[model samples]
Target: MISKSTIDKVFESARLEEVIGDFVQLKKSGSNFKGLSPFTDERTPSFMVSPVKQIWKDFSSGKGGNVVAFLMEHEHFTYPEAIRYLAKKYNIEIEETEQNEEQKQQANDRESMYLVSDFAQKYFEDILWNSEKGKAIGLSYFKERGFTDDTIRKFGLGYSLDEWEAFTKEALDKGYSLDFLGRTGLSIIKENKQFDRFKGRVMFPIQSMSGRVLGFGGRILVNDKKAAKYLNSPESDIYHKSKVLYGIYHAKQSIAKEDNCYLVEGYTDVIQFHQRGIENVVASSGTALTPEQIRLINRLTKNITVLFDGDAAGLRASLRGIDLILEQGMNVKVCTFPEGEDPDSFAKKNAYEDLVLYLQENAKDFIQFKASLLVEEAQNDPIKKAETIRDIVQSISKIPDRIQREVYVQECSRIMDISEEVLFNTLAQLGKKNVAEANKKFKKERKAFEVVKKEQAVEKIDVQYQLERKIIEILLLYGNRTEEFEDLLLKENEEGELVLEPELHKARVFEKLYLDLQQDEIELSNENFRTVYYGLISKLNEDDSFVIESYINGLDSELSKEVTSILMEEEKYDLSDWEGKDIYVKDKAESVAQLVGETILNLRCFLIDKRVSDLRQRTLEKKDGNNHEILEEIMNYHQLKKLLSTKLNRVL
Candidate 1:
């Protein structure tokens, strides 16, 4: 586990905007930064990053958090992983307490696989730079491929020696388990003999979005006909190839800044583009493009331009990817190189400006690209032409944006020489077919969904919940602020009559809240709320000035998130035009007294009403004629409820 001081240092050093800016493009919007959500595809920016508070909220997806929480949500990192990432970024030294045997056993399996993969990457890199054969074979191969030494090191390129047990022996000597080694696909075991998986190959470490090595892709340098040219690590606990795009870690920042991503085919293609100063490029890593890969790009930007070789094979690849990109609701353009040249070769052969100019001048929208490619194939064949048009229309129908779809259809009509009406009819028929298929699935699941809805209704917030939440929110926001409150109680006067007496008390918000809840014997109904309430009471008693950031840091992740949501949710609508349109907003501090008093009174009224209902139920259920005590209890609670309601300016 990470030391608490180290974690605090990370939080203090890492700025929310600086960290999230690595993934999403944030434009200056007054005191905050506004950007399109990295979690959703949209035109208008709804994601807001507050630099002063060091928090971010994506109004589109309803996710808000500080830096670590953002990493956890966006990168699927564990708490320690996020901490380590920030520590690495900020250059903070992480100090960890030594774990005992039992504590060591408690470490998760996935984390162990990550540790092994990281170790393997370092080992391979050391071998490439330090070992004799590695330098002769691996370094020579990379240098001959036009890879500069700086680029080789930037990409973490390395080499493995040809000896079967070289890496395996070193890994075992370093106390790594063979189990994790096998799980990470680093070491293979055959007949109880261990061997290195990528021996004699130049290594390229594939990383996650946050730049942690999850797997490796290796190229075999020897010209052996029997061997596969390229090999990748198998699927494991931490690495899923279909879900990862090579060079995403390198390209995410540029992709967000440039507002475009250039998609290529292989690792070298991505590296070559990066070498040419085009950093916003990623590769499918030689696999068939999957929707998952496209959606990964969708998180950064809506625009994707696929680079292909100007040949039939590349056209086929581009065709396969166009529909997938359209299905994910992204704007895809195609840029094909000259004949017999792939992205790697083409980029290497040209200068930066020439290559960029070529891409900009040659890029075609998906619709235009499709029509131009199919038009020649369908010459003088009416039936084939009809099928090609339908194919293009089907791709257009998969787009979620109606305006983009309509524009594409219009373009298709103009290019294919077909009427827009014909395309619309085909699109409507396809839409109807899709809806009918969906209705079948919906009908099958309708009863189950209804049951879930009924259960959710039962669990919906009650009056007590709203009152309790308000009380907690007030305490969290203004717990240390002093307030003047009126305290009322029923007491025995000298004439032996019960009379209401009122006294004015000046006390801190926390003091008044604790006294009121104690007087009424009220306990928060929600467990999390109760935990936070007690935390607030403790914090207020210990400190002269309340600081929410310090208090929030002491909380667990879930409680911290809840507290932040309560405090920040209202700030979302506050960012709108209400203030600019001559609408004056009152600060919460100015109305703290009334807000606190109303919350407490409403809570008391709700409790009294609940007691009255229980007593009435008891009166109804009793078979014996013993209803006097129940009736008296009900009357007392009802009268209290009415008194509280009157204070709240409500008629019960």
Candidate 2:
């Protein structure tokens, strides 16, 4: 288990914006940072991070908490794993006790798989550097490819031994489970026999954006016609190839910093670029481009420059990915190396400056590149020319922004020398067809239960729930603040009527809220709110100086989530720039006393209204002829409600 001191150190050192910015491209908004929701597919930014509060909220998905929560949610990390990730990111040393055998065995299946994959990576790396066969084969291959020792180790490149059972046998001897080893595809087991999957191959670890080893891609060294040259780990609980991009772990920051990503096809292509000082490059790992992979790049930048080999067939085959990039509302540019050269070879041959210069000079807008390449094939053929124009129009239709689509349409017209009217007409037909097909698919896939659910009436507002939530929000934001409040005293007036007399008193907000709720014998209706409410009050009572970050970190996930939602509810409006537009936003801090008193009064009014409702129901039932008592009770509650409503400025 990680020590409390270490966790605290992590919370203190790990900045929420900096950590989340590594995954999502965050732009400054007022006092906070805002970005597209990583949890949801959004065109506009709804994910917000508050550096002042050290908490983040995704208004789109309603997921919010401190830095740890963001990691847990975005990376699917367990709590301990999240803490460790933050610790590593901030360069804080973790103080953790060694896990016992039982504890290690108790880890979940996915975590165990992760452990096995990580172990495999380390084991492979050790072999590459230390083992005789590894140094002779794996080290030699990497050196021959023009990779320095630092570059090889930076990518965690390693080698698996030539013998079939070498990795499998060593892993078992070291207490790593065969189940996980086989599951990670590090070892293949069949018919009660086990052998290494990447025998006689060098290893290239495929890592997640956070640098966790998800799997590996191994390339064989020797010319064995019977064996495939390159192989990847099979799909497992941890690794999904389509969703994984090679070198994302190293390239994410550079991609975000440069505001562009370089796309290539193979692992070597990504490594060579990074080796050449072009860090914002990732590869598809030889898989066809996927929406999930595109979205990964989309998180860092809106621009993608796809690097292609000069082979005409390969370039043509990769054209489909440009359409995919456009579909994700990203700007795409394509660059191709000279014939007989790919990204790996070209980068190897060029100096860093030349490589950078070549990419800058050769990169062409996807439309221009697509047109030029297709025009050659369509030369002197009218039918093929029309088809090519239609194809370009279809690609243009994939762009989500209307203005961008229009701009691209004009560009395509100029490139192909086609009439703007003809291209626009074709685009309209394609749009209609797409919409019709989408509707048909939606109707066909629509479940009976979903239709029934949609037909259900909207739920009415829960007054008690709203009031309870409001009280919690007030407590979280201003509980530690000491404010002078207008205390309402119930007394007999000149007319012998129950009257609320206002008296000024100074007390901490939590003290005032606590006394009010305690006097009324009220409890929050929502269980989550009740837990957070009591915990928050207890913390405030214990310490005069309340730190929301530490308090939130101490709570369990559910309560932490609730507290974050409450704390960040007001932050949502920060993105609106109301003050910049000459509309002033009310500072809640200035009205802490009134806000606290009003929330308490609202809760009291809601509860009293509920009691009155119950009393009225009892009178209607006429239970045991207690109508007289019920009427008197109802009248008293009504009077109380009236007094509270007066203070709240609400009609009874």
Candidate 3:
């Protein structure tokens, strides 16, 4: 396990903007930085970094964390790997434990799969560029499609030879595991029949949003109508076809930079636009838009401009997405190509600037786009026209935000040539229904969460209670401390000056509270609180001020809230205003210091006396050097007890 010292050092040293900036191009965004999400394909950036807090969050994707978390998410790194990577980048020497060979070779996790997939992606690219058969087939095909060598390599396009088992044989011989290759769908296995799944086909490795190759999509170059045009890897431990968008990994940062994701229908459409310098684009790879794919893009940017093949086909193809995108609280724009043209051919025909301008010019809000395209179809037929109006209104109602929904509704009213009142009434009904259904689902989900929470509590009983009380105490009484010291010994020196020193020094309430609990054999029971109290004590002993905010940042949400509650609750205790009780008020600095010291001493002595009294009550002291000595000890204890009582009376 990594040591707390190492984790803290790394966290302290990490520059949030610098770490996130490597993947995202960020400009000054108020006191923070903003960029397109590396996690999603989008044109506009909603990804934000707070250097002050040392945290980053993608409002679109709802993934937020420190630099370590960003690396884990963006690079698909394990905790150790992320730490090691940052350690290397910042030139920090890693002090790690030795891993045995067996432990090192243990079965790979999700991150390992990503690493292996990346290795395979690079290996396949090598096969495409270096091999003779690859040049004639894959190379020719990409070149024929007007892809430059740079573009081909950028996307890691590759090919598998026609000969069965050729690619499989090489990957196996390279010491890459057959299991991983099978998992990545680079190799296929049947009932005793094993070969390259993408044999004789040009391979397009499907990458996760983070650029890890999760699976592949292969197109056979051979002109055999008998064969399927494309073959995709089946859903594995990593890749799920319906959820992933092709070019997402490559396009995510660009999407975030542009603050919009250009959505196309096919892989070629994505490639062509990308090749033409429209980098903020991804394709659904001809699969219908799944919520996962939409969310994946949502992580990078909330604005989605869907590139339709042409007006009629686009209108037909984009209906489902229009409603789905609005439902996701995304801004959706539709831009259809001219008749018989698509994103691919259009990009090929036009320059990058023209493509950009064309998209800008043609893109319309989905409501307007749908209304304009479909109104003719419903021409004067009240039944069909009413259904059209309802369909458009339903899309508006799907918007999560009311303002956005209203804007869409107004657009729908104008474009559909319908009464604004009728549309508003219909939208209200649909919105209410959706909200009720959502509320029902939320209640069910909350109930499930409560059950899990209860089970977790049942498993950790004492820990939960301790955390609860300690957190409450921390919130309720942080700054206000009862003092425990007693006397101020004043002596007249040779110069007739009084030299005053405390015969007994005071301990503050927190220390007294902490020490008293220790004396009672009670320990902080909250796991997080235990961790924090020890850390705080350790820090303070090193002569550091207790930085509650810094400590809270390192904690997870539940613990952070607990800590915040503690701080805010302490405010309600009003330590400053508690001075009006004719207690330890002082007019001078020395007097103030003396009073504080004395109060602290008094509280400590009281706790000590109480502890000793409890010990005596529980079990009588047996052996004594002398009865007189024991009696004297009892007498001294009483004196200390009375002094503590008098001090508490004065201070309280």
Best candidate according to lDDT: 2
Off by over 4 Å in 2: 445-450, 453-455, 580-582, 623-626
lDDT tens per residue, model 2, 1-652: 8998998898888888889988999999888998888888877888889998889999999999988889888888998999999888878998988888998767899898898898899999999999999999999999999999899989999999999898899889999899899889999999879999999899999999999999999999988899999999999999999999999999999999999999988899988889889999999999899999999998999999998888857677789999999999999999988998999999999999999899899999999999999999999999999988988998999999999999999999898888899889999999999999998988887797598888999989998888888888887788888899999999998999999999998999889988999998887778898888899899999998898888888888888898888888888997787887999978988888878888888788878888899888877888577587788888899888888898888875
Per-residue accuracy of model 1 over 1-652 as CA lDDT, tens digit each: 7999999999889888888888776777657777777787665678888787677788888787778889988887888899999999999999999878997887788888988998999999999989888889889888887999899999999998988889999999999999999989999987769899998899999998889899999998779999889999999978889989999999999998888999988999999999999999999898888987887887678899988876646475458778888887789998888888888888899999999999999999988888888888999899989999998998999998999989998999999999999999999999999999999999999999999888774456678877888888888778898988888787778997555577888999999999989987888989999999998898899988777776776778888777777777666664574667888777777888888888888777778878888888888899997999889878777766766777778987
Q: Provide the clash count, candidate 1.
A: 0
lDDT of 3 by residue, 149-252 (tens): 88888888888788889877877787777777777777787878779787788888887654567888889897898888888887887888987899987887
Give candidate 1 regions above 4 Å deviation: 24-52, 55-65, 312-314, 443-460, 483-506, 571-590, 618-630
RMSD of 2: 1.7
Top candidate (TM-score): 2
Rank by lDDT, descending? 2, 1, 3
lDDT (Cα) of model 3: 0.71
TM-scores, one per candidate: 0.90, 0.97, 0.69
Residue pairs with colliding backbones in model 1 are none
lDDT scores in order: 0.86, 0.90, 0.71
